[model samples]
Target: MQPPSKTTPFSLPVDSDHKATKFRPFTISPPHMRAFHLAWISLFSCFFSTFAIPPLLPAIRRDLHLTAADVGRAGVASFAGSIFSRLAMGPICDLLGPCAATAAFSLLTAPAVLSASFMSNSTSFIVIRFLIGFSLANFVACQFWMSSMFSNNVVAVANGVAAGWASVGSGFTQLVMPLIYSFLINTVNLSSSTAWRVAFFVPAFFQTVTALMVLAFGQDLPDGKYKRSSNITGQISKENAFTILLNGLKNYRGWILGLTYGFCFGVELTTDNILAQYFYERFNLDIKTAGAIAASFGLANIVSRPAGGLVSDEMGRRFGMRGRLWSLWVVQTAAGLLCFLLGRSNSLWGSVLVVCCFSFFVQAASGLTFGVVPFVSKRSLGVISGMTGSGGTIGAVITQLLLFSGSSGNYMSTQTSISLMGILMVFCTLPLTLLYFPHSGGMFCRPNYPPTHQQHYDHLLQCQ
Candidate 1:
């Protein structure tokens, strides 16, 4: 066997004193707190805007007199915009750096959200919401930035924090938006139209504030921080970028992971977006009760993500087990079964418990899904992430379509459809377990081949 290469991409030089020097200024002085605070603040802002649209769907529907199909169509529009924006933004992030890209997108998203307040018809509403999704596509930029700043050892925690914060946005909207709506109706004496407008305005104001923070505090990451293929040549040409993305698509591992994400997120969006409506119809619960129950998913997701990462790391160290992909499949399958059972039950409290358990598993799976991303292609993390995220968006849109058409504006029909989707989700994981986990090792390391071969291409495409 050849001697171990001194410059293995996976290996990092250990420096005991280097850690001290790297953290000395931050630990000894309080100034480092600024970076932490700003980072989290920016993250929270992104999270808030990310979730703001879903929770307000009911309010928008009622105020605009839109049908359930209209609502679904609007969601599709927004997701389509997000998909397109991510495709463009991924390469831009790789070229321009995440800081400038995030700032630009954040500023652009603010105006889109603000303009949403003025929408009067479904056509205008759909257009504006799509624009909002396009602008808020800065989320990909933020993730790339975080990956560059934190080392691999701490990357799990950093990513978990960002994801957890994003999940919290749902709860924040649930807790605050209804109250704001009530106040607008009761105190401000506004019409339903204006009340919903104010709700959009609230997130817009916060988004603008976050944009300013990003502009002031965000910094470009140092070059050559993350892993990339050594054989990558040329100066990040546009052709090179497209080739990287195309390679990821051709790679079976990437598409398999993407499919897994698509199914899981499809099920997740179905349950989350429609949970309140399901409870309200099935159990005769009020909107408030339904909102509280639905909010549990986000709360559980936020808690489960970091826990999943910790567990993955511990298992890897102790048992040499890198079964995260399989584990997620199992978890989602179990959750699907629980959801089916919950749908069959009549007791409100019993349904809530089952739903909570389902949420926990789904969230855990969510965390684990992303936990494997950095391992896929350290160089092409951003573009790969965007591609996978786009798949999830497609899943979400499909789920929305199913919910829309099958519901027929009837509650019982919707529940039945949702239960069937859950069952389908359970089976979706089987192929993932058999195909993905067994081959995960290939994803973690670069292929050994001649530089001129297409099969040996470097993964890094862009930062933004």
Candidate 2:
């Protein structure tokens, strides 16, 4: 049995490389779909743990006597913790495989999620938030797992569906946290402080259970466990992890995609932190009401991101890489405009409508970004995924520290900061125009050598 060549239009059932040509998301059978289910669900629990605090911030602020400055710094610290972890997770994935990487990281961070319940002061609160944030690196593992399980043709959709479903955890927390808090206070008769504190136990438990599930059920590659190659001396040095790391770093496309991801996914992270507070203060909504509205932004990922992947694939079938780039540019541009409008809207209803629309485009842009990622360099996929994934946290850190961080004393008003972020997002989309490949040309040009039906996947072989 041989791997599919440059001219093979479709793969055989369970091809020699063990990658699946067709994607059947509903089925949870072994190899492809089973990995897909575990990958997204594990990351979803991480997302749940990472963001469990934001919706409860109002009650937390009063109980802990936290000022605006303290809250701002905590937000920055949460995103900051993930930045380095995301960069490191890439090489770790290459060395250890996504299954081991995800399971280990999840277990390591689960205690941090539980620790959030014990923090009494702002300092301890900030530290616990930082530790819990390390789980976000699971995102890199999720993307890496999907790339390993699916073939080139369906990889975009696989990546999109996996990531999109996992991101729903952000919204799920927004909606569920408030309800749990209400249940504790109303039904259990616990005080507000105790209710919020005890609520932490739920996500912590959820995260721990999911991590164990991955360890017991998940496989690294489609066929089985990841095996390392041996050198002439029979020492296990077959794949030089450093060379894989360096090769991915050398590719210019990864950097461009990383920068672009900052605005879309980074903005999403920043919003997840601030949105409930925004509606609470600006609109005078109750805690539960504000959380439900905030959840809408994240829940939109269910359809929006997959739509972006679907549209990108359809465009690629017709216009190759150029179509993918153009669709990304257009959709992201709309997201920026809506973001600006969201800040400027005066009424609560109007703002909510704008936010829902903004969520769609911004999340779709994330899906579109990853749709191009797997094609960058198959050999260095983990490294490239790490670079792009880290870029999102970096973007959130900058957005938080400079614009949303009230501790800075010179930070802009929240509304003004959001509008300015929109302007920055528009500028970020410009880099997508600069990306090009050998057989598939860029935004403004046509390919010098047009590809045949099977040659469309040739970019999987080389970065250029």
Please give each candidate's TM-score.
0.79, 0.93
> In model 2, how large is the Cα lDDT of residue 138?
96
The global C-alpha lDDT for each of the candidates, from Candidate 1 onward, is 0.60, 0.87
Runs in model 1 with CA error above 4 Å? Answer: 1-40, 53-59, 222-240, 319-321, 405-412, 434-464
Which 10 consecutive residues of model 2 have the lowest summed lDDT? 228-237
User: Best-fitting candidate, measured by lDDT?
Assistant: 2
Best by TM-score: 2
Off by over 4 Å in 2: 1-16, 228-237, 452-464
lDDT of 2 at 179: 98
Clashes of each: 5, 0
What is candidate 2's local distance difference test score? 0.87
**Tens-digit lDDT string for candidate 1 (1-464):** 11113753212222221111121112212122233344445655655565565555667777677776666677666666777676566666765666677667777777787787887788887787677766545656655665565554445454555565556665566556666777888899998678878777888788778778766765554333222333246343444667656655555555566666666654665566567667766888665666777777766756776565555545444432245554666677887787677667678898888888877776666555665665566556667666666666666667666654434555446656667667766776665644432222322333343335422232332221
